[model samples]
Structures are given as C-alpha cells and as structure tokens.
Target: MPDSGLEGLLRELSPQVLGALVRRYGHFDLAEDATQEALLAAAAQWPGEGLPDNPRAWLITVASRRLTDLLRAEQARRRREDTVVQWTLPEEHLAPAADRLAADSDDTLILLFLCCHPSLSPASQIALTLRAVGGLTTAEIARAFLVPESTMTRRISRAKTGIKTSGVPFGMPPEADRAARLDAVLHVLYLIFNEGYASTSGPDLVRSELSAEAIRLARIVHRLLPDDSEVTGLLALMLLTDARRPARTAPDGTPVPMSEQDRSRWNSEYIAEGVALLSEALPHGPTGQFQIQAAIAALHDEAPRAEETDWPQIEALYELLLRLSDNPVVSLNHAVAVGMARGAREGLAALEKLDDRISGDHRFHAARAHLLEMAGEGAEAVESYVEAARRATGLPHQRYLHGRAARLRES
Candidate 1:
C-alpha cells in the first residue's frame, strides 16, 4: 500500500487497537502509550512489508505486547521506589491471540465515551478525543489549537488521569447516565466542528483537517445511533455548513461573506445529502438546535441566488432556536436574520435590545456594522466595522472587517 493509504488505515485502527488492549488489561494510559508505539511501528514497517492480511488484528497484537512491556517497566520502577504498582502484568498471554471475536469487536465508540468522561473538563475532553480516538499526535493537536505541544501533552495526561481516578469502566455509561454521556460526546464534537469552521484566533479562517475529522467522527456516531435524531441532525448540520467551505475564502485568503460567495463553487452532493438527512431526522424529533441550524443552512443552500434566500423562514428558525437556548451569539444571529427579513432599521431596533446581552462582543459590532450599512448610515457603519476589527482576534476576521470599513469610506 502507498504511504497515505497505510497511514489512513493505521489511524482508523488506532482506537480499536487501544480499546482492545485497555478492555482486556485495564490500563488506559499505558494502553494509549502502547497504541502509539504500535502505530509508529506500523508506519515504519507497513510500506516495506507490503501490508498485513489482518491489519486490525496485527495492531491489537502489537499494542498488547507493548502494553505488557510498559506494565512490567512500571512495576519495576515502583518496586525500586518501594511503592506498589496499580497495574498488573498479563502473564498468560504476551499478546492476546488474534481471534476473530477480539478483532471484530469495535471499541472506538466506547473509547470516545471514555475520553469524554464526566470527571474531565471540556478542554481536556476535546484534547483527549482528538488524541486517542481521532488518532492525532499530541504535537499535531497542539498545533491545530495553536498551543505548545507541552501544554497539550499535560492536558491529555490530566484527562487520562481524571478518567483513571473516576474508575469508569471500559464500556458505555449505565443506562441512566447514557443520555448525559451522549450529550457530552455530541457537544464535544460540535465544539470541534465549530473550531475548525471558524478558528478562535488564527491566520487561516478554516482549519480543514479539524473540520473534516469532526465530520468523520460525527458520521461514526450517526452510524452507531441511527435512530437518534440529534445525531442525524448534527451530521446534517456539519455537511450543509461545510459544503460552502470551498467559497468561504478568496484567492488572497480573505474571508468571504456568505451572501457574496459564488454559489457555483458549493458542493451540490453535500447539500443534497444534508437536505435528505434533515428531512429524515426532523420527523423523529420534537426538534433540536442542530436540526434548526441545519434547516437554516438548507434555506441558504436551496436558494440559487443570494437575494432569493428565505430570510423570513431563517428568522423564524432563529426564533425557535432562541426558545431552545438563550445563547447571546444566537441572539446576534437572530438580529441579523431580522435585519435581512425586515428592514435595516427594524434589525437595528432588534439589535438594540441585545445591548445588555452581547454588546461588547466583536460579532455584535460586526452585525451592527452590516445593518448600519444596509440602513444607509455609512459613517456609523464605518466606526462599527473598525471597532469590530479592533476587537477581533483572528487575522481573517480583522482583515474582512477592515476591508468593509475601507470600502464604505471609499464609497
């Protein structure tokens, strides 16, 4: 196999291999380390060795042996320090026999639940999920988040320690806690997607790798829980939103507003799939945030021209979303929708009500600037745009806001 193909195969199997070792031997941290070692071994040898017939089983066997070696080393270290080790060696099998039953059982989803254990913080959960289940190295994760490798390493370590101390099992949470656990899992995935779609602070507007990985993970969850409306909704939302990514930035890498983007560049297949998924999921639910957001995205996508967008329907959906959650960002979005659906003056009035909510945020200023320009208040719009640019952390956001202000000034 080629290098890229081999790498993809190894990443897909990393979590399964780690999960198998942890499930049988009961050492998550050690098993994780061993899994990384096993992956490294595979990457080094798989190309020249010309691919094993049973790659998953090969990984599990290698990881299991590495785990045993790690356990023995830890035991010896603890013995030298006159302290007892918490983990025991599996003396019977150096590496468990590569049986069909062991190889076939997938623990990736279980590993996700474990990585998102309730004892850990949200940051740790995201870090650990990307590290363990997503098969990303610590340095790669750190770079994606724009943090030092050491910082990410500590975060992952702390997360694993938290999981160990909590003594969570190697299976799904109990029936009573499953809902909450699933919610955590979904929320982590959402955060990851959002970060990838719009990085908090970076030169680039979109982190394609992070967004793509989030979508991949969401698809896995959707496949596992096909009947869950929220899962389907989340996947649809990601697909619909990401479909526009090709036109999200200019050739110069400047951020492009959705209204001004060339619709010809949008991914039609993704749009169709997303619409189908939303249609399939809505009837299964009383409605959720992801479904509403996906509905809004569908409206934008279905319109052949920007002016044809159903702003009123989008405004209505935003209203419904507000009823579900009182997020200030959602309020700002609702105000923008109102501006588009109604007149700019009416939108300004709606935005005025949010002064006590998100007035200090850059998004609030950006929306105000846009509405002000629509209302023919060029002077005020310029100031708002400059303010928004000043408050914005991401380079792309700052550039766009400044460009908007400069254009209004020239006009």
Candidate 2:
C-alpha cells in the first residue's frame, strides 16, 4: 500500500514537476532527465524515511537540486563562465519559498498544451503526453500503440528532442492559434480515454486511473473554454461510455458484449449526468463527430434493455458520424446496429460494402460472422470467426471468437 501510494504521488505530481523543470531548463529533454533523477531519489529515500507529508514539494525540491547539480557539472565540463550567470537566474527564480510548487490551474493547462505542440506528429504528441503528463510507462504505451517497447522508447526520446529543437513556446498558444491546436488536444484526450476504457494489453479490463485523469483534463478544458461544443461533447461522450463500464466486463474478467450485459448494473447517475450534459451541449448548435457519438451512447444508456435500444436513432447518429468523420470503424459499427434494427440481410449488404475498407480489422470479421450466422450461413460464419480469432490481439476476445467458432462446429 505504501508503494502504491508512492506510485500515485509520482503520477499526480509528474506533470507539474516536469513543467516547472521545463520552464527553468528551457528544454523538454533536460526536464524529463531531471524528473527521472528525482523519481530515482524518491524510490531510494522514501521508504526508509517514511513518506513525506508533502510528497510533491519534496519531489520538486529534490528535482531542483538535481537540476542544479547537472548544470554545475555541465558548466565544469564546458569550462564556460556564463554557466554561473545562467545558473543564477534559474536557481533564484525556480524555487518556491515554502518548498511547495504553486500550480495554478492555467499553468497545468499550459503544460497540457505544451505537450501537444504542433511541431511534433500526432503519434509523438500522444506518446509524449502519456509519458510526461499521464505518467504511463513506456511498456504500457508500447502496448497501446501495438509497437515494440524499444520503438516506443525511441519515439518518446525523439519527441522530446523535437520539442527542444523546434523552439515551441512553453505557454499556451494565442487565441489565433488556439483553434488549430484544438484538434491535437482532442486527439490526445481521445487516446487517453480509449487507453483507460479498453486498455490495449493488460491483465485488467479497465484502467480507471487513466480514465479519471482524462476526465479531469477534459473538465479543465471545458472550464477553460466554456463555449467549445466539441469539448462539451467529448466530456458527455466519455461520461456516457464510462457509465457502462460497470457492465462492460464480467466479475471474472471476461469480456461482455453490450447486448448480453445486465442493464441493471449500469450507473443511472452517470447516465443521467451525461444526458444532461449532451442536452446542454446540443443548444450550442456546433455539432461535431464527438457530439454524434455521444448521442449514440446516450441512446443506448437510455434504453431499458438491448431490445429496447433505438437502432434507428443509432443508425441516424452513425450516418451523421460518418459524414463528420469517414472512419471505417464507424461504418462497421453502424452496420451492426443496422442489422439489429432492420433485418440481417440489410445489415449484411451494408457490411459487404465495407469489406474492402475494414479488411484489416478483426472486429469487421467478428461482426460479419455474427451476421452470417444469423443468415443461416453457419460454415461461412465459422470461417469468419476463425479469421477474427487469428487477427485478434487480446486474449479474452480471441478466446470468445474461437468459442463462437467451436459452437458452430458442434451445431
């Protein structure tokens, strides 16, 4: 429990500590290196000394000292006289009098924005933010991206280098540039929520810590820019989806399809909250892809049972979503809903149209298998399920598909 508490403390303070370091060092790479040194010091010192009452303050103090030492060593190696003068400014300006780092709300948001600088690619931005802000391990991020751990480590290292070299400002962008950065911010939040809601590769089905952090960040963004409908939509969408998390997996940790999930387990409070937020967001009249997705989740939450789900309404939402963003995944999901609402044949036709688009997706095969089974094509369904199982990455999901295929064989 003490170790867990220490881990949590490090997670919560990492962004603030890193931000202060970056502000002082004027380089993301230096800040990250210094933060790591601070964490190492904490690991060595905390257990024997007992956890500090003010862990963040202790971390900040330790990190500041480490940075000073690093600067002094660099100055000595370079034999530069200006190093002393340069060190004085940061030493004088960086430390707080009370040993506590005062993190104003704006400062935190600025940290988030800085992590999403336009200089980096979208993948790099997500990786860097997960590392520096979300406090995720490189291994976890590697799993999320379906890449090798070494690849992810290199990606993060390069991202920090790019930020340092690009001369991106540490503060928030101007109002003129805010709109451009909004997409990057939204993408980061989306990745954060997805990682939480369905961790790519982990023993646990849900990572509530990541989800909670994403929500906190979203709420901060909403407060900072109240009239932004997309931000409101994202918050509403996350709330609606997270509301179903209680029923998303069985107690034994197996995946539960939405249709078979016990609706009684759903959190009415979160659903109601999400619905109200979506309603308020609608009047803003600036509907985006997220708003449409939230509406679909809202419709499902409002239903009493799987059969009660408004498939027609969901189909409409999907159509709108496709128009807003032509993602093959959205089309695949829409095909399933259409099959449920209409007949399997109609759904099969829609699914067929998406064959080329979703050829690489395992869910595409899984959905097609279900539609085929419903249409009395058992052999085809079995083949599709076998393909799905072959492509599926997660153990539980692969097992589910294999089981489905075996059942067809038995029949």
Candidate 3:
C-alpha cells in the first residue's frame, strides 16, 4: 500500500489490521476505537514522515499502543497495581503485517463474523461493517444512507455497545451459525455496492470507491468460499451493474437513461466475468434473491440494444423476485417491467397500485411520468416529471427529471 493514497490504503487494510488487533486483545470494542485512532494518527503523520515500507505493520503497532494505553487506564480505575504494570502482549502479535500471508485468511474472516454478529440488527450490522470493516467514517456512512450524522453516530455507538454485551467469540463459528452470519455479511456488501452504484442522495450519481471496495471484499469472499452459491450470485450482480459504469452517466454528471447508454462503452471484461459467474451460480440450485437479480441483470447485458431486451422474461423474473422479496422497490420494478411487457396503460395501472405505498419515492413518480409520456399524455407526464424532480435526491436524477419535463413542455 503506497503512502500517497492513504485513504484508500487504510480502507483496504482496515479489516485485516483491525481483525488482528481485536483477535490479539480480545476486545472488539476497544480494538475498533484504537484502530480508528491509529488511522487518524497515520493520516496526520504518514504524509510528513514518509510512507512506511510495511504500512500495515505500522498501523498494527500504533493501534496496539493505543489499546495498551486504554487497558492501563482501565486498570488504574480498578487500582490493580500488580497486573497493570505486568500486562503485556507478545511483540510478534502486535506486528501482524510481518506475517500477513499466514494471518490474512483467518483474521479477515473472524472480523467479518464479528461485524455481522447475529445479535445485531440488520441496520447495525451494515453500519458496523462499513465503519469497522469497510473503513468508512460515520459521516460517510450516514451520507450513504441519507441519515443525519448525529443519528448515525448514535446508531454505531449502540451497535458497538450491544455487541460487547452480545459476547460473541472471535474467529470461526459452528457450522450451523456460519450460514446465518454469512447471510448478513452478503447483505451488507450489497448495500455498500448499491450506494456506490446509484447513490441515495448526493451531488454525484455514483460513488465508484464504495462500489469498487465492495467488489474487492466480495472477491475475497468468493475466493475463500467458492462453493457458496449466493456469494457467486452477489459478485456477479455487482460486476454486471459495475460494468455499466462508463455509460451510466453523461459528461456533465446527468444520468443517461438506460435506453440511451452506449453499449459499446460498457465494460466487456466485467460483463464477461459476471456472465461466467452467474452461469456457475445457477447450477448450484435453489436460486436466491441475489441470483434472481443477477439473472435479470444478465438478461439486459445479454441484449444488443434496449429494444432487444426480453421484456416478457424480465417481467416474469421481476414477478418471481417480488414473490421472494416483499420489498416495495421490487414491486415498483415489476410495474416498470409490466409496462414494457404489456402496455403503458397496464404499466400505469400496476404502478398506480403502488403509489400509496411508495408515494414519497422519486422512482414512483418518475415511473409514472415515463408511462404517461408513453401513453401520449404529455401534459400529465410533464406534471409527473416535475413532481419527480422535486422529490429526487440525486443530482443526476434531478437533472434528468427536469430535462424530461422541459422536453415535454417544448413539444
């Protein structure tokens, strides 16, 4: 890891380094605090001091020192005179990066298990993973989720405190528990990718860093747990989505509607890999939500043009997906597919059913606007477009929405 790009460097090593510290100290909460302090210290020092030959080792040494200080403070409060002075860990344990090849696999896996502990709620698991494993600050995670920084701060704090009480052991779990914990891990990774792929609310349409990091972590999972079908499915989904990165937006940061994106510019390499992975995942049997979603993305990628998309198959897949996931967003997408497969009126009717449930969602209004335009109700469509623009949070979405209304008005 080069010292010049410390942010990305720290993010990449966060899980591995933090894992080592937590495992050595047997204090997840304290280790996380110390790791964060180490990162902050590095941010301030490494630039002026020059990059260390072994950056990970430097971080481990720094965080371990912090952890030792914390332990000494706690021991002083207890007035334990003998143990406080005697407390010491093996020096080799503090310098984990010296033997990373030996520790990487187990340490990273254990860190993930702790971050995705079953006792934590799904929200907490995602927050903790981003903060601890993903090396995202509480503020960045808050922005990703469209929540206030204060709220996110409390949420992460609660998660850390709750886990301390949960009494989870470090390292591997029993076979039965492994499956459930890994499920949470996959969910957090997908959420991170989705935020980066299509930002929830921000000036930019995409945050490539988050998506790229998610892909890196997913690849790690795929490498270690090759037999896990959902792992393959998720990696495929992310790659397929990421393949469109080059064409997803225009030069000015406005989103290029899916129909307008140039397929020639799409990342063929990622698409090829995604296609191969999806093929492998399908044979594993029992298609999951991730598999179904990946299959849908594969269909679109398989097409040469928007007109060539298999709408009926996509509609069918969306229907199956909605059955598996009672998510309102899935229902909204199903309605979009219905419009394309059936007619604008049919799509409008389907979308209208979800209006009450998804009224506040910009996509709900945007879909209605598109359907209305297709139905030749330009005036109504213009109104819908404006409404969608008003509700839209992403700058690109807002630009596209307002542009749609402007075009409709001109016509």
Candidate 4:
C-alpha cells in the first residue's frame, strides 16, 4: 500500500481515462466530471481492496457508466428516450496499472491543446490547464492565483464553453493554428514551472515537487515536438536555471540568493546538458524568448566566479529580450543586468522606466532596494526593502527582505 505509487498511477490514469471519455462521448465537461469521480472511487477502494487486474479498464468502465447514467437521466427528464444510450458497468478491477499507456494515443496532447485553445483568454487557458491538464483541484488553482473559488469555477466553465462554441476538436490542431496554440501551451507550462520554481504564496521558497513535475511535463512536450527550437529552448532554460536548485536553499530550507550560492553545489551535468541544448537551438537562429533567456543563463553558468560573470553580455542579451517581449518582468531583470554591467545609477534609471507597470511588484521593490543600496542611498534602500518585505507573498522571501531591511537600518 505505497501511497506515492498509487497517487502517481492515478495521476497518469486520469488524463487517459478523461481523454478516452471525451473522445468517445464528445462531452468534455461531462467526461471530466465522470473521470474525476472514477478517480475518487479508486482512491477510496484501491488501497483497502487492493489494486485491480486492469486498472485503466476499470476506470474507463466506471467513468463511462457514470457518464452514461448522467446522460440517461438527462434524456429521461427531457423525454428524449430516442437519444439515450445504455452502457453496462464492469464488475472487475487491476494488478498494478500498466507500465505507461500507448505513446501514440495523443490523448494527453489533445487534452492540452483543448485546454489552451485560442478561443479562451490567457487567464482562462491557465485555469483550464491547471484544472484539466495539471490535475490541480479548483481550490488549489484558486489559492495559487489568489482568486475566489467561485470565480475560478466560472472561468473554467467559460473556457470549456468557449472551446465547445469555437468547435475546437479533440484531436491535434491544424498546422496553421498550431503555432499560436503551442505558444499558449508553452506559456501554461512555464507558468506551472515558475510557480514550482518560486511559489507566489507559500512558506517554502522552492516547491521542489512542483518544479520537478514541471520539468517532467516539459520533457513530454520536448519529446512530442523535438524539432521545434522554442521547445528545446524552453527545456534548456528550465534545466539551466533549475541546475542551481541544490544551492537555492540552505540546509534549513531558508532562501539563498544566487550571488551567495555555492558554485560547487550547482549541477555541472545539468549545466552542460542545458548548454548543449541552447547551443543547438541558437544555431537555428534566435527562435524566441526562451532561447535568449537560456543564452543569458548559459553565460552565468560558464562564469567561474561571481566577479567573472560577463555582465556586459548579459546586459546586452537582456536588451535584446526587451525588444522581443515587452513583458515588465523582462524589464525588471534587464535593469538588474544593466546595474551589474554599468552601475547602480544606470540600472536605477532603467528600473525607473518600468515603475508604471512594475512598481507594485515585490521583485520591483526588492530590485530597486538593492540598486539603491549599491548607489549609497541607504535610507531609500531600507524603505524599499521594507515595502518589498510587506508585499512579498512567499514567507521565505519575506523573511529575507525583512532581514535585509533591518541590517540596512542598523548600518
């Protein structure tokens, strides 16, 4: 009765069962609900009763029965007896779920594409992705974004309706529509990874499990679309950045800044692999934002010491990044690089330009505080640090910022 084993198997089974129901029934909403119920039944019954011989078939039969029952009830209420389809439930169960379902099934990929359908807005796409594809509960997704459960529920409902109304197929999207859909998919994946990389609201600074899950998903996407430069770039960026995971926190799980991290602890193997990935993607010629960011990270990985970092090149790459993406987050990081390459004054000036959009962000205040500190504006730095600590969501970061503010005030 290994809990982790059961949970992992259930997670894998969810998409396939849900996808099969969706494909057969053509009712994504109903199929999703039924699949969840089937999973719930398994969770309750499997541990005590023991694993069934055919876990997937058991799930499918149960979920299909549930779906059929619902449809039958609706049809009965509507007096549409002609449309009612009868299905018999399987009485059997599993022996240890199969080792990986059919690879060519494309069920997961289709589910992902539908979740990120262009008909839905980015926020809606994210909500759907987290719920349907990421296997997150509605409450968990709501907590992650600090949105109301009712609101997220509506958002997910609306997204599904949009997909239905837009006639989004439950199969691979056409080539002409794929680029845009894939962008949304990548964004969702990155968002998931970023949450795992640095949770917005949590006691722990790094949600290691979540980050690792993100990487696993990224590998899935890379495997599916091997030739796409952006795919390689995305994987490379994640690997390059995640290579520093071991040194990101202290033994007590306290946050550690990049500058103070132990270089020896950084995974050299991940760095080499990431470097190879970025190198391959780059020669294909600047595919997108991920590649450029990977390049910047590669430069840092190549540097032997903090003082030896090629700040000038990093600064230039950030500038190029700003051109490609007008994202305020990019601006914030670019300003930090500018500060390092040039000076606190130049960095502060660049940061000032982003105050309109980024002023309220905790990272903005923290970055501004650091720059002010370097510029010898101790009082201003302390004030900014205090604000950052106040606004910060992650407890680990809040503690770090508070400590910083205190030291600056004492000095």
Please write out the lDDT profile of model 2 over residues 30-70, one tens digit for every residue. Answer: 66777888888888888788888878778777887777777
* Cand. 4 TM to true fold: 0.81
Off by over 4 Å in 3: 1-13, 33-66, 80-105, 121-123, 137-155
What C-alpha lDDT do the candidate models reach, one value each? Answer: 0.89, 0.80, 0.85, 0.83
The TM-score, computed over Cα atoms with residue i paired to residue i, of candidate 1 is 0.95
* Tens-digit lDDT string for candidate 4 (1-411): 699999988887787788777765666787789889999999999999999999988998888888877766665765655645543222222222222344454677778888887778988887887787667788877776667999999999999889878876677778798888888898888887788788788777777655676677677778778788999999999999999888998776667888888999999998999999888888785469999999999998888888899999999998899889989999999999999999999999999888568889999999999999999999999999999999998888898998888999889
TM-score of 3: 0.83
* lDDT (tens digit, per residue) of candidate 1 on 1-411: 878888888888888888787777777899888889889998988888878888888887888788889888998888889886555686655555422344433578888899888889999999999998999889999999999999999999999899888988787678899888998999999999999999879898899889999999999889878899999999999999999999999987778999999999999999999999999999996788889999999999999999999999999999999999999999999999999999999999999998566998899999999999999999999999999999999999999999999999999
Candidate 4: deviation at residue 74, Å? 2.6
Predicted candidate 2: what Cα RMSD to the true structure? 4.3
**Candidate 3 has which clashing residue pairs, if any?**
none
Who wins the lDDT comparison? 1
lDDT of 3 by residue, 1-411 (tens): 355577878877777778887766666777888888988998888888878899888888888888878876766765655544443443535544422444435677677788888788878888888788778889988887778999999999999888778877667778888887788889888988988999878789998878987898899788878888999999999999899999999898988887889999999999999999999998996888999999999999889999999999999999999878888899999999999999999999998788466878889999999999999999999999999999998888999899999999999
Top model by TM-score, which number?
Answer: 1
